[model samples]
Target: MSLNPLRLASKALIALFCLSVLTGSVRPTQLEVVRMQGEITMVTRNSPTTFYEDRSGPTGYELELAQAFADHLGVQLRVVVADSLSDIFRLIDTQPGVFAAASLTRTPQRERLVRFAEPYQQISEYVIYRRGGLKPATPADLLQGRLMVTAASSHSERLHDWQASNVPELSWSESPELEVADLLQMVAQGSLDFTLVDSNEYRMLQAYYPTLDIAFNAADQRDIAWAFGWSRDDSLHQAANDFFAHIKPQPLLANLAERYYGHLDKLDYVGARRFLRQADQKLDTYRPHFVDAAGEHGFDWRLLAAMGYQESHWNPRARSFTGVRGLMMLTLNTAKELGVKNRLDPVQSIHGGSLYLSRLRDRLSDVPEPDRTWLALAAYNVGFGHLTDARKITAQMGGNPDLWLDVKEALPLLSQKRYYRHTRHGYARGQEPVDYVQNIRRYYDVLVWNDEQTQPLKGEELLASSAITVVPPLL
Candidate 1:
């Protein structure tokens, strides 16, 4: 009773600290909690742009980014897949998840509920419609058809803003059960009139849904960032910000973007349509041969198939003006070397091509995949000597010789005298391999998507497909 008021308050704080220590109730910082758990949980949506399983287990742009962050923290990554975009936000709000990395755009409405890390990407939203349909040339024309988007998505938020400010008549429905890919499919099938998709996503998926075309821009230049919960403890948030700052200047970020988004726009509407048609009408006849050869040579069957399509459009008797022929397009010397008796025979041609590609890949044992795979494919197309010349040029130009992105750039230089003059191989059609690899990657993507749609993963296999291994530090 006689103590000073400040003294009494200090005494109370000391008692509380002692009690907290005795009861084991001391609150740990978010970073400490994560360190104790030895794992960081990532909340994401299951989509091509977010998280999904491919032939090589779980791999997506977001998943890989999350993996890298987890590696930086020296912790394991635990992926939690949410059903919808709304579910992703709900999980981040309620759960102790580290962050949501599902390619979320930072909208004004979302900023009120959660804090966002540094913006990593910028994209535009486009109103998508099927070809041969009445295109909505302007925002006012959006009212002419049935438009829909994912519930709780930035696309819907954009629509709401448009409806409020300029076009009061612009209206659409929100589907909580479907994703952007589903909406695109609906538009292509004529079930829905139009939908909105981000430019990056539309580009990545356009080859699969060739009929869908961008009508107009719904929103432009939006920032995409990782979302964290708004809380008193912002240790994780600060750490994430630091992580981004460290990587922003490095090649790690650029390589990740190039890996996922660089080659997507290689095929146009007409080329995609033609590829799809041929894949449907002709690919089946040689599927068994591709499967057998790929299995024998340790390659994905779809990849082998894509290579065949790029080589000859899957024609058994395809002949190039330079004397390469057949489904895999083997020259006489290469065919003889690979023990291919008849280059026109589909089975023999596929086996020979697969073995040859595998041998080329093995030759570059020092190179890391998927760069190794891509380099091998380039060699398969432009000859190993020319590929070596390009790698030399890449190193000379101060680019990594192992990265496909750098090598592809240097490849075109081979056609020019100023660059190729000092090279072992003096002149080559360098641009051909660039286009060739891009075309195969696009075709392979379509095939993978088509296969997934027809046969999706389920149950135990789905659970086992998580990307858990820590990636080595980026160069």
Candidate 2:
């Protein structure tokens, strides 16, 4: 009864084998899947928006949705991270109780093959091209060739519809082996003149690949929904529908969307490009200091490094016009409180900053993480007092004070005299902290991506520890 996933899966396999022989049929029904496997075997492709590996294991928008559905079914979530759209559909087609939550657009062709749950989100398809390149003015212009898209994608359907009459010569190659990110990269490099991507995918990747511009809208807005095997019995389909009905109007959807795409628009093409370049140039110099501080404070060294970049762009000698100085950009009073004597010392600055952040995080012991860590970052920028006032406002406005998503919405109201006048900490510039936390999160994501793809740099190698501790940094 208290078995782990491996044991449960093993028992499920054995039970399924027995059932196949007993029923004299190998094909499992929805009820059979639920009875045999103690988990929801959901199918999806690996992408930023669909499903992908991270430090915490597999995570993404669709994965979260699938996990919720599994919980609703009172079972575990077993994600099948497929390589292509076709593979995703195939799993749903062949496996009982299997479903695809890869942010699939509910197209007519797909609707004919599999049943779709109630639509959850809507998206539009667009033809994308490199900025300043030969942009396609219409389907005919695109028909000249150099078009690429993922095989069996909604984009291909749009192309087929166009080629049927509008541009009978229109042709686009589908790379069954490649993902949307790969195709977008090709368009960015000018290897392909055109490709189609959903708006959500573009929003998630725009910060990273800013040069890829939208050429034209290729299709009308479409609904995204989960896919189940087409069957006369609608048990799983009905269950999925009930799950959607419950979450569609709740804060969960908004919060989840914010978690992934909230900071996407924070950085522009030039800003992101600049950050990546300096991530190599200036960050390496102060990398050791941040690493030492991070080791002592128990934080991701890159997170600390990203904070340093955000604070002062890793410039040890950099001074803000507001009298904040050095790599960590600490004020004299705050630096003194953190036992930082020389605010300009790069190593001391990072250590002081880390300690100050730790102290702020410590004060928020009652708050749950991620929000707790984010609130600490906000407090670090403005003041803890102002953050409290904003939290109070969040509660007064019927928003959850403990959730960063809700608190952030209330934060900007601090600038209004009508709102901040009654609070103890009055008229604080709240937007600064929002930008601060979001930017660092973006930078940290980039750093993590780089580390996963390449090797991570350990600050211990560049500089020996003088006296720092090994406490994990604040979240």
Candidate 3:
């Protein structure tokens, strides 16, 4: 009954051929190939809204989502940087086992070329122009100015659709060499008339480019999702949909959005201009002190400087109504506890404040970072007791006490007598802490951007010293 080895091999090959004829082609599923390779390759573009280098090596809103999806599949994530939006799609078209997660807006044209996973976020397109420039009130007005968008982008597609259908006069050019951020900068510099950008991107960059303003919303809200190369196998696409479904009810997506965008709207044009002015005129004088304190305490010097600015606007002689004084705005008791003989001395105040913040973070050892750092900041503004009371209130409600977003909600409730009367620390201006933390975060972001722009020639190691971080260094 046993067959010869050569005959058995021939029989097996014939069976495989018959199966292939029936199924068209037999190949490993995309998910199976990824698992077998032990890694998934993702293509992304370099932008603040997508993937970019920071102190933590590489991170961004889109990168975070990609990493989560990779983890969901039980594989490692490998990122390949594409030079342009066109290049991103080209890589997808040519490569195997690769996907795009560059905050791509799903479009009809794109849907024909690739498969987009479930949409994770929605954003509207806006026509951006410099302040004091000719503002376009409608699509017709865009014809008057030089409007341009990135090549192969959703913005360009929208413009094309508009031009072909209703506004035949509405014409725009595509920039093969520039990105949305570059166009934004050009508009800010008065070199470009107008450009199209997403609402979220506009919000994130508005503080940095104070001169930029929205002319009008150009398109309706669109779905943003991950894109897979066109293939017969929808295995990976279904897996990505499953991953999104699993995280839909989780805090990861919300928290990531909050981390990247929550504080963006805090600084308006006037506030942004003032911060830039002071940073130019006064930051140089205290820069060394901040750096020294940061080195001693292992904090980003920009964070300390931002905190200092928020506290007293970087004035050494500044004093509050509550008797807090100096650049870092320390109370008399806090200054004494930190061994500062002269509360008005900028060096002493800066060091004392840094130490106090580190200690406050230490007290929050149980809380997970970013929330821990934000909560410590709130504690720095209000008090540890009030922060604990806020946490208690957050827990009493159906909110996650560990999340800053939820805790921030409960924080304002402390101001109301109805809620404060039951807490251990009654009657605190909870709204102040929320504003305090947000202002500091905004300042920190601007400072980071300023540093990066000024030191573009510096290598990554030097640049990383000015990068942002959510985690506090251990004492």
Candidate 4:
């Protein structure tokens, strides 16, 4: 088949045209499906800022923000959770209608690989090490320890930039196999002397590992945004810009960020350190009851413990001035209704509270869970009548009745004469429950992070359904 080069090229072009005509196929540009198919696939990177499975399926700022864009387009949302950042790049490259919600930072190298939307968040990089370990007070201080970072993360990139331009003293190893959370765990375990993580990442993990501390800022104010594959058409990118603008004024972005990071940093180091110590010192005696009750009621034992802490700080003999008493802090009427002979007994209190929360949760079967769990917690604080009143207000005010996010804002309005006047339940200390639920949620997050369950849930699957595993770091 050795013919003239021009003749061979002409024949190949002719064949390509013929094949396209026969198949009736036209390749769409990146993210063009929103125009033709009215939908887009969201690529989730399984991280706190990007995507992580929660007790209520996938819940993260990335997932929620992506959902908002999908809703705006009047299209169906198809979620694809990427295994890693590399997987995200590959998917975005080969697939149309796919965009990344990985909270990816805009970097010069990445800009060549993919286009980024307008920045939604600004974060700083930090030098992290265990609390009592070597403190890197300055750039010179970094030389005193074994430094490591996740291979592809922005932390490593920052180090590389420093190495190139300014600080020849800057040095660190990279862990190819570790996720950012696993890196945080490694530092907490003292496997690595120090590592670099973003400030938000450091703050979020500090709630879990109170022993980890920030030595100094590595880099400040990097922009984080969504990433899409490079393409000639900019329809989806423009739409993303519009979406962010619309939500910014409505403060949706701030609300979503608050849901994840707001309650963090509320519990101080001593308070958190005390909680972990007590979990070791005291939780064993009550673990059996918590585990049993949690199983029967479909609640995490940590959740029940958080409730116990919020109510009585794990003191079975503790009593409130309102006459509520014990670890679960049951009122006399609640105790009588639950058939408790003695409200002061730790066993009875835990069981009764678990049962009560279970019953309340059952009432919300029509609603989505995790949010339902949150609503149930609020009902436990104020009566169901008041909770419903708040829900009604939320619905009337152009918000979701079933979403805890909306209902929480409306909850405090119940104390206002203008709002509560229309309700069956009269004025209540509305701010108390709002704070109550938030504080317990903080404790619950920490508990889930610090403890491993003794028993796996039988036949019942958690809403997240799957998890990521990390191998122990190589020294």
When summed lDDT is taken over every stretch of 10 residues in candidate 4, the lowest stretch is: 457-466
Candidate 2 per-residue C-alpha lDDT over 1-475 given as tens digits, one digit per residue, 9 for 90 to 100: 4769998899999998998899899565575578467877888887888888875577898888788888878888887778778888888888877888998999999899899999888888888888888888788898554776777888877777787766766665666766676677667766677889999888887766768788888768999999999887778889899988888778878877888888777788798889888886777777777778878877788888888889988887889889999888999999888888898889899999999888898999899876888899899999999999999999999999888899899899999999999899899888889999999888887777666655422323211322211211112
Q: Write the per-residue lDDT of candidate 3 for residues 144-250, one digit (tens) a residue.
A: 77776787889878887777777776766665556676678767766568889989888888998898888888877999999998988878889999999999999
Report the C-alpha displacement of residue 132, candidate 4, in angstroms.
Answer: 2.1
Which consecutive 10 residues in model 2 have the weakest lDDT in total? 465-474
Which scores greater on TM-score, model 1 or model 2?
1
Window of ten residues with lowest summed lDDT in model 3? 466-475
Q: After superposition, how far is residue 6 of candidate 3 from its true place, in Å?
A: 20
TM-score of every candidate relative to the true structure: 0.90, 0.87, 0.89, 0.78
Model 2 residue runs over 4 Å out of place are 1-37, 455-475
The 0-to-1 C-alpha lDDT of every candidate, in the order given, reads 0.86, 0.82, 0.86, 0.79
